[model samples]
Target: MLARQLEQFSCIRQARVQLAPQSWQSGAVIVLEPARPEAMPDAAALDRMLDTLALIPDAPDKRHVLVFDTEGRRLYPDHETDETARREQEVALERQALRVLRPLLDGNGRAEVLVSLDEAEKGRTTGRRTISVLLEENAVPETVRPHLESLLGQACALEEGRGDALRICFLPARRNAAALRGLALTFAVLALAGMAAFF
Candidate 1:
């Protein structure tokens, strides 16, 4: 039943609509916005979208990078409280969202996550938080790109005040296991050589 719903949601014709499970709400909802023709999504919406997407069922071999627009309302909604309180809230939300999504974005899913705030609002916001995830490119199979993209797009749309000029990107996961193994072997050999010299 869930699989069929997911498929139907993915087939939605609008380019900017997205669907995903919401961690806070514990329910799936549809987010709608204009196509990528207007302004980009805000920081608050981006954060909410990531929070929602963390609940998706991802494969172990697929890698993903969830980009959040930190300058928009997608991640941090403007509040009347003092700047300190608002900033603290934003940071807390980002940390919690990352903790939940980290496992799904790592390894054969060499996910590279990034949260980018618009340059104009870089230091102006009351609550400021920056989070990034870096993983090898090409982690997930090409077949999954459409599905993931659809999910992300839907997530962006479901939020409040998401614009059409949004620019969300997903990179392919890269393989670096061989490079890591080589480095480990080199370190082991060096340690053994040093021991022999000391004796």
Candidate 2:
């Protein structure tokens, strides 16, 4: 819906919108590829685009929009260099976590995880490292949890945020292996019961 609205403008060739990091609650980032590289949207056009983004339910109440050209240039919040850097750093952390978690999840791209770095520990060992992994029913398989946590802890220990505690959380996303196995067992039992009754 938002993309269609943005496409109505002449300057926008295509508009791709994504929540900051990975989920909807996070702020929005709109990457715009212009119809003509030399003819970027004017300030008024940008304002209109931002307004449309702000109207989305997931958008924050403060309504700050970050626009980036295909070249990784910041188009708005021009003064918020620190904020931009912070978001980039968060994204970097997220990518690192995914590097380790993806294989464990069978390369499921739909898996959601957020890795947040504490700014105070930017270059120091005293900063906190938080890894939030979205799992089904707040459960992590006994076999997977310890190994996954160990891997993440090792990653944090090696990074700048190693001095403080390493926090790991399991948020709700898709069902994990244990849950799927239980579901399969239930189906098997029901099927056996039906066959017994028929025989």
Candidate 3:
């Protein structure tokens, strides 16, 4: 069944279908990764793929499905009122934002960011052309900070958007795994001391 479904899209060189035992929302999960990084599925091909996913069994739950790209972008079940799509879009945006921001981090830096689209009105057309990156406390270097914003702008310009949108962000930079080990050791020592005092 999967092989037949895959043959329809030449752009989709490979496909995988997994019937997960538990889902936050119950349905089949279809993952598609392109043969090339730059390959994108057109609207009609995407629609057909969604239709193919619809045929999968939803015996124990409602017939809802999710399709994700290699970069973690959600591609299916994008209904008008689906609240889940908003969360998925945020995830996709974050992945894209990180692609631009990670290079600025000079190895020691780590960050968690929230990427959002704020609508701006210029004239008759409505736009969410501005990409806003909210850097939740991070270890970004002071020297790299100056040039990071311009690089983001250039990165967005090279990609596609709803309109002539551009990217701009202030990404800041971690918790080392070694720090967690130290925390565990401290807890153990405290527990032993308390037990000794109690006895």
User: How large is the C-alpha RMSD of every model relative to the true structure?
Assistant: 17.1, 6.8, 9.8
Candidate 1 local lDDT, residue 71: 27
Residue range 78-184, candidate 3, lDDT tens digits: 55433344435544555676787777665665554443443435662333434555543454667766776677666544335545444344443346789989999
Q: How many Å off is the CA of 123 in candidate 3?
A: 6.5
| Model 3 TM | 0.42
Q: How do the predictions measure up, each by TM-score?
A: 0.28, 0.53, 0.42
Query: Lowest-scoring 10 consecutive residues by lDDT in candidate 3?
Result: 18-27
Q: Could you tell me which residue pairs clash in candidate 2?
A: none
Which parts of model 1 have CA positions greater than 4 angstroms off?
1-108, 116-135, 156-199
Model 3: lDDT equals 0.56
Q: Candidate 1, residues 1-199: lDDT per residue as tens digits? A: 2223222333222322122212112322223332342444454544443454445565111112122233222323333434324333433443444454454453546443333222224444321223344434454445654455344334322232322222335554443689989999999999999999999
Candidate 2 lDDT over residue span 1-54, tens digit each: 666667777888998765664422456666788999876785565876677656
Model 2 TM-score is: 0.53
**Top of the candidates by TM-score:** 2
- Local distance difference test scores for all models: 0.38, 0.63, 0.56
Q: Is candidate 1 or candidate 2 better by TM-score?
A: 2
